[model samples]
Target: MTMATYKQIESLMGTGPPAGAKQMQVMRWASKNPPKDPNASFSGKNVLITGSNTGIGLQAAIKFAALDAAKVILAVRSPAKGEEAKQKIIAATKRESAAVIVMQLDMSSFESVKTFAVQIQAQVDRLDVAVLNAGIAPPKYATEKTGWESALQVNVLSTALLAILLVPMLKDTAAKAGRPSQLTITGSFACQYVQPDELKLSPGEKLLEKMTSPEHFNVEKSYGQIKLLTQYVMKGLVDDYSYDVNGQVDVAIDVACPGYCSTDLGRDFPWYIALPTKLMHLYCARTAEEGSRSLVSGTLLGNAGHGKFWTNDVFTDPGIMVTSDEGKKLQRQAWKEISDICKQKMG
Candidate 1:
C-alpha cells in the first residue's frame, strides 16, 4: 500500500476500539451480506449522480449504467476525470450506448450549481432520481467563493440549493410519468452525532478552529453536523413538497449513510491517522459498489421509508443530536441562513 494509505489505516486501528461501533457493525454486516434482491435493476430510469468521477460516486454511476438506466448524468467538477470515469464504466459494462453523460458541477460554487441546473433544465424534461452524492469532507479551514465555510457550503448549503432548484423539474417528471420521483441525499452517521449549536461559523472564524474548538471537536462529529443538517433539510423538503393538495408529485426525500468505504476521501490526514484508516478500509470497508446500495435503494428502488434515515436496507434513527427539538430548530435556522446566502449571491 502507499504510505499515505498505510498511515490512515494504522491510525484508525490504533484508536483503541472503534469509536463508531454501530457503524462498524453495520459495515461488517454489509460486507458479509448481499442485497436482499440480487436481480434488481433500474431499466429506463434517469439518474443524476454528482461527484461521480471517483470513489463511491464512480461506483454508483457504474452500477446505474449496468442496471440499464436510460441516462446516467455523471455530474462532476473535472471534465477530464469525468470522461475517464465514463470510459471505465463503459469498459466494465461493455455497454457503449449506455447513455452516460457528463455535466460540470462544482458544489462549492453557487454559480456553478445554477449553471448546472440550467443545463439540466434545458436538456432533460424530468429527472427521476437526483442523487446528491458529491461532497467535500472537512478541509483544514477554508471558505467558498461566497465566503461561507467550506464544509458547510459544500456539504450542506450547496446540496440544499441544488435540491430546491431541481424540485420543480422532479415534480414535473413524476407528474407525467405517474410514479413517485425521489430525492436521495447521501448523509453520514455523523449527522446524528454532532452538536446542533455549531452548524454555521461566524464571519472571519477559521473553519478548523470552529470545528475543533467545539466541545465535541472530533472529526466525525464535525462531519456529522453537516450530514445532520442535510437530513433535516431533506425532511423539510418532503414536508413542504412531497405532495400537493391532492398529493400529485409524492416526491420522496430521504437520507442514507454509506458505511465508510475505502475511498480517497481521507487522503490528506497525517500518517498516524491515515494508515490505520486505510487498513480498516481494506479489511472492513464495503466496496463502493456496495456503498451505493443504500443510495440506489433510496432513490431508484423506492426502498426508502419516507423521511427516514437508512443504511444497508434497514431504517435506523438519525443521531440523537438531530432528533431532539433543539436540533430541529437549529436545522431550520441553518436552512434559512443558507437560503439567504444563496439569494444574495444569485442576485
Candidate 2:
C-alpha cells in the first residue's frame, strides 16, 4: 500500500475498542474542553461553513477567521442567526467587518441548497474551504421537502447535492490560488455503532419508504444508517478522483468526526432522548470548539488527507463496511443510485 494508505489503515487498527474506564476519562476530559487553535493563517483564503449558527460549525468558522481568512461565509438556515454568529466570530477573532458573511441554507431542502450555492458562487470569488457541517438526528420518523426521512434528507441527500455543486467551484479556486482546496464534510463516528442489518436496504428498493416507515422507524438506527451510507459516498468520491494532474488534487474532499459534542443536533428529539443526551454532553461531551478541531483539520490537511475519513485529526479507514468486498460493491451500487437521484431531483 502507499504510505498514506498504510497510515490510514494503521490508525484504524491502532484504535482498538476503548476500555470502560479510559473511555469514561476521555469523556470527562472533553466535557468543557476546547481544542487549541493550530494557528495556521489563511491569508487570502475564503471559507464557507454550513449550519454555522451554533456548535462545531460555528467554531470552525471562528478558527478560519482567527487564522486570517479574508472572507468566511456562514451558510446557515437563518440569516438573523447567521448574522449573530458573524458578530461573535468577528469579535472573537478581532477581524474586519467583511471578514464573515451570512447566507441562508437549509439542508433539508434541495432547492434551498441550490439557491445558497448560486448566491455564494456569485458573491465569492474563491472558495478555499467548504465545510458541509450541517446535519440532524431526528427524534422521530418525519418526511421532509425532499420526500425522505429527515436525517437522510439533511445528512445524505442534501449534503451530496451541495458537494456536487461545490466541488467544481473548489476546483476552480484551486487552479486560481495555486494551492489545494478542500471540501470537508462533518461526519460522525456513530457509523461504528450501526448494526449490519441496519444497512440492508436492497439496491432497487425504495430507500426512503423502507428506511423511514414509522412502524419500524428507529431514530438511532436511522442516524446510523445515514452515517454508514455516507461512508460509501465518501469512498465513491475518493475512487472517482484518485488521480491528480501535476501532483496535487484539484480539490481534496474528506470527512471528519467531531466525537460527541454539546450541539443542537438533538434539538428535534423528544425530552427523554434529548435530556439524557444533554446530560451526557454536560458530563462527557467535547465542547463545541474542541469538536470543531476535526472539522478545521479536515479542511486544511490538503492532499495528504485527500478522500480519507479522519477523526481526532488523523486519517483512518471509514470502517469494516467500507473495506469489505461486499461492502465495496454495495458502495458503488449505492453511489450510482444516489447520483442518479441527485440528477433527477436537484436544481
Candidate 3:
C-alpha cells in the first residue's frame, strides 16, 4: 500500500472514518493476508456468547464450536433466531448434537438479565469463557423499558450485570479445575475517537430529542462513549475488589476492539452514509474470522501478566486518547454511575 493509503487505514482505525483512514487502508491490506493459522482450537471449554444469533456474535460462536468447545451457549433474544444460528454453526463445523445450545437473554430488561443468569447457574457447573459480545448501535435514539438510553443499557450496564451475576459460577468452576477463568468484553475503537460530552441524556428528555441535541447529536460519538464505558467497567471489576475471603482472585477481565468490520451494526444509519460505509467495509473490513482474533486472544490466549487490552494477539496500548488523564477520570466516573444505577435496578 502507498504511504497515503496506509495513513488512511490508520486514521480510520483511530477515529472510525477519515481520521483513521490510513490505518483503515492498512487493515484492509492486512485482512487480505491474514495469518495462515487463524483457527486456534479451544477443545473441552464451555463458552457463552451473548447475541450469538447474528453478525460478529454468531461468527464468534461458530469459531468456538469449530474449536471443539464442550458447550457453546447462544445467549440471544429470540429462541427461533438462536436455533437458526446454532444450526448454521453445526452445519458449518459439522459438530454433533449438543455442540451449541440456545438460551434466552434480553439485555434491555434487568429482569430478563437476572433470569438468564439464574438459569445459567442451574444448568452449567462452570463457564470457561464469557464473551459479552451482544450490543446495539441504533441510528436513531431509543430507550429501554427502564427509561435508560438503549445503547448505554445494552452495551454497558447489562454487560456489567451479567458478569457480576456469573462471576461466582466462573470462579467456582475455575477453582475446581485449577484454572483461571476469562471474561472478554468486545469494545470498539470508537471509544477513543468520540468526544465524552455527548454521552448523557437530559432527565425526562425523549430519546430522539436527546439524539438531536446539539451536545449529543452525533451517532458515532454516542456509540464510542458507551464502548469507553465498557472498558472502564471491565478494568474496574478485576482491579477494584480484593482477593476473596478464601483468597481466590476473581476471574480475569480483558477488553478488546474488533476495529471495524462488515456487519449489520451500521444498518440503521442514513442510506446515503450507510451505503458507502457498507461498500467500504466489504472491500476493507476484516472478515468475521479475522475480526475475532483480539477477542479470542484476550480470553484464552491471555496470560497471568497480560494487561487489560489486546489487539491482533498482542498487548498494545489503547492509546493516549483512551488512557489520558481526562479519559481515565471520565472512565472512573462512568463506572461509579453505572454501578449505582445497576444497584438500584437490580435490587
Provide TM-scores for the models.
0.83, 0.88, 0.84
lDDT of 3 by residue, 1-347 (tens): 35653443233232122234455664675556442233456788899999889887888888888878899999999999999999999999999868788999999988999999999978777798899999998787777886767887798888888878888887776777666677888987666555545544355444333443445635756776677777778766776531356755557677866666777877678998798887887787877666765565556543342236655444455645457776676566666766776677678
261-315 in candidate 2: lDDT tens per residue? 8878888778889888877876878878888887876776666677778775556
Candidate 2 similarity to native, TM-score: 0.88
Total colliding residue pairs, candidate 2: 0
Compute the lDDT for candidate 3. 0.71
Residue 184 CA displacement from its true place in model 1, Å: 0.6
The most accurate candidate by TM-score is: 2
Residue 51: error of model 2 in Å?
0.4
Question: What is the per-residue lDDT of model 1 for residues 1-347, given as tens digits with 9 covering 90 to 100?
Answer: 35653443233221122345665675665566633322346677788999899987898888888888788899999999999999998988877654888889999888999999999988766698888999877535556776666777787778878888888888888777777787888987666556545555566544334443435344545676667778767776776667856955467788866776778887777788788888887667877777776677666434235687766556667876567886676656655665666567657
CA RMSD (A), model 3: 7.2
List lDDT for all candidates, in order.
0.72, 0.76, 0.71
- The clash count of every prediction, one per candidate, is 20, 0, 20
Candidate 2, superposed: residue stretches over 4 Å from native = 1-36, 202-209, 241-248
lDDT of 3 at 35: 23
Model 3's TM-score against the true structure: 0.84
Error of 1 at 243 (Å): 2.2
